[model samples]
Target: MATFQRHRAFPWLLLLPQLAIVAIFFFWPAFQALRRSFYVQDAFGLGERFVGLSNYVAVLTSALWQQALVNTLLFSASVALGAMSIALLLATLADRVLRGAKGYRTLLIWPYAVAPAAAGVLWLFLFDPSLGIISRALGSLGIHWNQRLNGGQAMLLVIIASVWQQMSYNFIFFLAGLQSIPASLLESAAIDGAGPWRRFWTITFPLLSPTTFFLLVMNTIYAFFETFGTIDTTTGGGPNNATTTLVYKIYQDGIVGLDLGGSSAQSVILMVLVGLLTLIQFRYVERRVQYY
Candidate 1:
């Protein structure tokens, strides 16, 4: 009994520092934001009056808010899908085919080591309409691609930029998951005359379900929140608010507009949406994750 208690207490003690940091930095700020959302900012932004749920109603009723919400959801879903798919394909190819696989893996993950803002800047240069390298290449083919003039192109650029940055993370996770699967199982499948695709779908994919589920949750949150840098650098939510996602809108309200109350309300909504998504994924897909 003493040993079990000591073991558990030791782990808790080790976690105390991190837990304290989270409480102070994360939970406290979130609670403050929630409290602030019920208030209104004064003319000079010095005072706040308790407006109850009016701010929430205002945000919900606003058409611009609605568009931001939809754009956020679409961006999150598309980027997560694109990142996961491309990473899975790359990891599979590296695991199966490529010579000097470790070298290739190192090279592949190198882009992720670059700072997010730097990566965004690099991609912006490549996609720049006037004097970009890729722009020149497309011009040779008489294909004009201008993200600034087109909303769809702007969204695509954002998605591609996000996917490019995140694929490394997904690739590492998936490669680890693939490598963890026992060779005996794959050998048995091969003996049963299963093709590579069939073996992967029937045997490997099921084993990888847990990793996939984890990545889906993490990547969704990341796509929604952490891609703000990329969006800020690449699009500035431009072309008539076409690329303005919820996080960017929050930034515009809180930081740029100095409307802390409205921004807090937006934050509350974002937190609720993310919480619901996480819950749904764990509740529904968790049972489907089979382990060897």
Candidate 2:
């Protein structure tokens, strides 16, 4: 029994470092944000005064914050849906590769290794108004693509950058999920007169639900928080604040605008909002997931 207890304690001992890291990096900052939310601080951090819920009220009532909320929802939805859909398609195609499969998958996964800022800059050049390869191609086709002044175009540009940046991550999970599906099941469906599309809908899709659900949650989180670097690099949430997401707004308020209290409130709200979103997904979305 003592040996058993020692063995059980050893696993937790291994986890101590990770726990310390999370506590220091995540929980500590979160606690600071929560505490700071109730107080307005001097721009230079020389002083702070407790202000109750006024910061929250201001953030909730401001038009800019409202617009940021709307933009955040739209951006998150677009990035998550677009990335997952494109990744699923790519994974499906990659799974069918009979030759050069390693190279094909490797190419698909290469983008995931690129930092978000770097990826955004790469796409920025690709879509730059003048002399960009894609921009010139669009101009030749009379599409007149320019993100500088057009708010809608700017939003689209950021969305595309975010989707492209996250798609590689989604692809890896989807490919793994696809490969894990039992080949015999597909063969059985094929033998049963089920067409490819029919078998896919009946077997492949349902089996991939676990992976899809997981990706949905992770991608939503990515869109909410991780897209900041990409959006910053690409659009700067610009063209009249058309692409200003909640995370970006928080940065603008706290770091740029020097409204520390309002920014802390926004950060707290964002954390709670994401937590609720994850719960909602697990509560409602998980019902559709077929683990087997």
**lDDT of all predictions, in order shown?**
0.91, 0.93
Each prediction's number of clashing residue pairs: 0, 0
Candidate 1 lDDT over 1-292, as tens digits, reads 8777769778888999999999999999999999999999853767779999999999999898999988888999999999999999998888885678889899889878877788888889998999789877987899787889888888988999899999999999999999999999999999999999999999989999989999999899889899999999999998888899999999999998988889999999999988998999999988898865
> RMSDs, each prediction?
2.1, 1.7
Per-candidate TM equals: 0.94, 0.95
lDDT of 2 by residue, 166-243 (tens): 899999999999999999999998998999899889999999999999999999999999998898998998878999
Q: How close is candidate 1 to the true structure, as a TM-score?
A: 0.94
Best by lDDT: 2
List candidate 1 segments past 4 Å from native.
3-15, 42-45
Shift of residue 205 alpha carbon in model 1, Å = 1.0
